[model samples]
Structure formats: structure tokens, C-alpha cells
Target: MVRGKTQMRRIENETSRQVTFSKRRSGLLKKAFELSVLCDAEVGVVVFSSRGKLSEFSSSSMQRSIERYKSYAKEKNLKHRGAEDNIQLQLCKQEAASVAKEIQLLETSKRKLLGESLETCSTDELQGLEVQLERSLTNIRLWKKHMLTEQIAQLKAREKMLLEENAALDRQWKEECLQHSAVSEEAAHDDRTSQHTEVETDLHIGLLGRGRTQCLLQA
Candidate 1:
């Protein structure tokens, strides 16, 4: 009678287990060859013993058979890689969105600091912003003070120049006044001498007329 089908359990005896492995490995290879021959197709088989020994069979040179297997494997990998690339693209988009969100937050913060009040900010936040504005105002005040100091220096320089110009004008005016006084004194002296000479001539003529009258009466 045909032995009943062996139970599906591990063979406890090492020799039996090894023998079974060999038999199964050979049967699988034989089946592979049969399939190739019947279908007029290429075939390859590879097995490893429990002791880590390798066994292989192929329709062609082992290298060529491996290369062919790799080519077919690459085709499968390409299909999987397309899916993987889509997943990676989705991940990249998510990361970019996250980065964009972070950038928007930073921009909002900067805008808040620059005195732009948005609906997102609270009154307390606005107060903090006001403090920062006050600090900025203080700095501006200091800068204005510096500018005013420079302007004051410039004004002082202009004032000194004006003073010098005024002093020079005063000197010129004093010199002109002295010249006019001297001219007036000389004119007055000439007028007095002319009047004295006219008076003396008149007195001499009158005396001469009285003497002529006396001499005619005596004649």
C-alpha cells in the first residue's frame, strides 16, 4: 500500500531532514526544467542547503541568467519606484507648506513689530508693540539732538561771520564820519574869512566919502 501522506511536521532526525531537503530541492529543479521545455521558455533555479551550500541551474550561462533576472526585477522596481516618487513628492509638498507657514508666522511677527496691528494680535501685544515704538522714538530723539547740535554749530559760525561783518562796517562808518566833519570845519572857516573882508571894504568906502565932502566945503 502507498505510504500515507507524511505529516506536516519537522523531521527530528538530522539525516532524514537533510535527505528530504535534497529530494525537494531536486524535484523543484526538475519541475522547473520540465516547465521550460514544455513551454519553450528559459528557466533558472537556485537553492541553498541547510548547511549554507549553494546549488543553481539555468538555461544559459549563470551570469547571463542573472542579468536577465535583474532586468526583469528592474522593471518591477521601476513600477514600485513610480509610486515611491509620488509619495516623496507629497512629502516634499507637505514640508514646503510647513516651511511656508513658519515663514508667514515670522512675517506676521515682523509686521507686528513695525506697528501694523492685525486682528491676530491682542491689546496686550499692542502694548508691547507700543513699548518697542517708544524705544525707537527715543533713538530718533537722540538722533535729532545730534542733528540739532550740528545745526547750532553752523548757526554759531554764521553768527560769528555776521558779527565780523558788522564790526568792519562800523569801522568804515567811523572813518567816513571823521572825513565829513573835517570837510565841514574847513568850509565854515572859508565863509567866515570872506564875510570879514567884505565888511572891512565897506567901512573904508564910507570914510573916504566923508573926507571928500569936507574938502569941497572948505573950497
Candidate 2:
């Protein structure tokens, strides 16, 4: 009968657990020693038991091996970071070149639009430029016409406002003139009444004085 594969798990019994730990630690140390001797490699192994006991193997001093591993890992990380930085630098250069090319194309097109560099243009290009210019002119004229319409509407509105204001001012001036005329007439009537009263009193006094003189002459 074929033996079934055993599942690996923690040994529950304390004695069995200790025995397994001892066996595994020794086997790991032996492997590290063999690897160092046979392949001339720097090998290190470390293990800790549940009770905080330590087991370690190193081709050289443990401290030296740990320091070497740290330095090697640090150097490898620096090399990887430098490679990423180089890739980023290359990408930036490509993007800058693309932007520069786009700017150059835009400048060339601008010059063409301004009629500054037409000597190198082909017949088809000139025709296209002419069509573009005509379309632009049409759009400009339409915009100008629309602006003028708006301006005319605004001016008409302003004229209507001014006319309304003038009408209001004229009506106010007419009303003020009517009030002034009425006041003047009232003042003139008062003056006339006062003069008439003074004249009547003077006439009555003259008549009475004459009667008194006649009565004295009779006496």
C-alpha cells in the first residue's frame, strides 16, 4: 500500500514540538554549511523558537553577513530607483519634443494665415487658403452685421428714452408756466383791489371835508 502524504501543521504536544524544532533547526544549519562549502557562497540562516531561544548559521560572522545583505539590498534598490528616474526623464524629453513640434506647426500655420510665407505653398494650398479667407470674411461680415443690428436697436431704445424724457420735461415746464401765470394774476388782482380801496377812501374824505366847509360858511 502507498503511504499517504502527511499534512504539515504545528505539533500540539510540547515534547513533540520541541523535538521538531530541534530537527528543523539542525537540518537548516546543515544546509547552510553545505551551500557555503560546496558552492563557495555566502549563506546565512536564523531561527527563533516559541520560547525565544535563537538558532543561527552564517558563512562568516553573523553581524558581517547582516551588514552585507543590507548593503546589497540598498544598492539594488538604488539601481531600481535610478532606472525608474531614467525612464521618467526619457518620457519628459519625448513629451517636450512633441510639444515643440506642435508649436512649430502652429507657428507655420499662423504665418500662412497672415500671408507672410506663401512662396512655398502649392496651388492646392493657395486655393484652400483663399477658400478659408473667404469663409472667415463671411463670418466676420455676419458678425459685424449682427453687431450693427444690436447697436441700432440700442440706439433706437436710447432715442425713445430721450424722447420720453423730453416729453416729460416739456409737460413739467408747461405746468410750471401755468402755475406762475396763475400766481401773477392773483398778485395783480390783489394790488388792484388795494388801490381801489385807497382811492374810494380818499374821495369820501374829500367830500366830507367840502361839506364841513359849506356848513361853516352858512353859520
Candidate 3:
């Protein structure tokens, strides 16, 4: 029969737990010792009991082994970080080179657009450039026509508004002139009535004086 795998878990019985700890601790320390001797490598093991009792084994002095492990771990971590930084730097350089090449292509295209440096262009390239230019010119003309249409519509609206405002101002001016003319006619009528009343009063006084003088002469 095939042996079953042991299901590892906590031993609930206190006595069993202590027995397991004793056996495992001895086995681990023996393995560590054997590994150190057989491979001529530094090895260390540390164990703590539930009551905080310590057990340790080392191929060399425990303190020296711990210090060496710390130093090696720190050096390995630094090397890993440095390698990552180098990879990132290489990626950045590659991206920069790609961008530079793209910029060069754009500059060459721009020079072609401006009709500069055409001697090296093949006939097919020149024909393609001509087609591109024609397309660009067509697009530009369409855009300009659209813009002018919008401008003309705006100007027309503005002119209509101005004409409406001018008509309103003219109506207001005509109303004011009519009011001024009516006021002038009323004032002139008042002046004429006053002058007629003064003339009639003077004539009446003159007639009375002439009658008085004739009566005195007759007397």
C-alpha cells in the first residue's frame, strides 16, 4: 500500500505538541549540521518554544553568521535595484531614439510640403507630393469658403440690426420735431393774443381823450 501524506496542523493536546516540537527541533538542528559539514557552507537555524525558550545552531559563531547574512541580503537587494534602474534607463533611451527618428521624418515631410529639397525625390515621390498638395489646397479652399459664408451671415445679421436701430432713431427724431413744432405754434398764438389786447386798450384810451378835449373846446 502507498503511504499517505501526513496532514500537518497544530497538535491540540499539550503533551503531543511538546513532543512534536522536541522531535522537530532536534531533526532540524541535525539537518543544519549535516548540510554545513557536507557542503562546506555556512548554515544557521533558530527555534523558539511557546514559553519563549531559545534554541539555535550555526556552522560558525551565531552572531557572525547573522551579520554575514544581513550583509549578503543587503548587497543582493542593491544589485537587483541597480539592474532595474539600468533596464529603465535603456527603455528611456530607446523611446528617445524613436521620437528623434519620428521628428526627422516629420521634418523631411515638412520640407517637402514647402517645396524645398526636391532633387533627391523620385518621380513617384514627386507625383505623390503633388497629389498631397492638391488635396491640401482643396481642403483649404473649402475651409475658407465655409469661414467666409459664416462671416457674411454674421455681417448680414449685424446690418439688419443696425438698420432697425436707425429706423427707430428716425421715428424718435420725427416725433420730437412734431412736438417742438406744436409747442412753437402754441407760443406764437399766445404772443399774438397779448399784442391785440394791448392795441385795443390803447385805442380805447385815445378815443376817450379825444371826446374830453372836444367838450372842453366847446365849453
Model 3 Cα lDDT, one tens digit per residue, 110-161: 9998999999999999999999999999999999999999999999999999
Candidate 1 at residue 42, lDDT? 86
Stronger candidate by TM-score (2 vs 3): 3
List the candidates' TM-scores in order.
0.43, 0.64, 0.68
- What is candidate 1's lDDT per residue for 1-219, written digit by digit as tens? 898899999899999999999899899988988888899778888888878999888866678888988999999999899999999999999999999999998988898887675677888988888898899899999999999999999999999999999999999999999999999999999999999999999999999999999999999
What's the C-alpha lDDT at position 150 in model 1?
Answer: 100
List per-prediction Cα lDDT, in the order shown: 0.91, 0.95, 0.97
Looking at candidate 1, the ten consecutive residues that score lowest on lDDT are: 113-122
Off by over 4 Å in 1: 1-110, 117-135
* Clashing pairs counted in every model: 0, 0, 0
Whole-model alpha-carbon lDDT for candidate 2: 0.95
Question: To one decimal, what is the Cα RMSD in angstroms of model 3 from the true structure?
Answer: 4.5
Per-residue C-alpha lDDT of model 2 across residues 1-219, encoded as one tens digit per residue: 999985698778999889988997898899899999999998989899999989899898899999999999999999999999999999999999999999999999889989989999999998998999999999999999999999999999999999999999999999999999999999999999999999999999999999999999999
Best by TM-score: 3
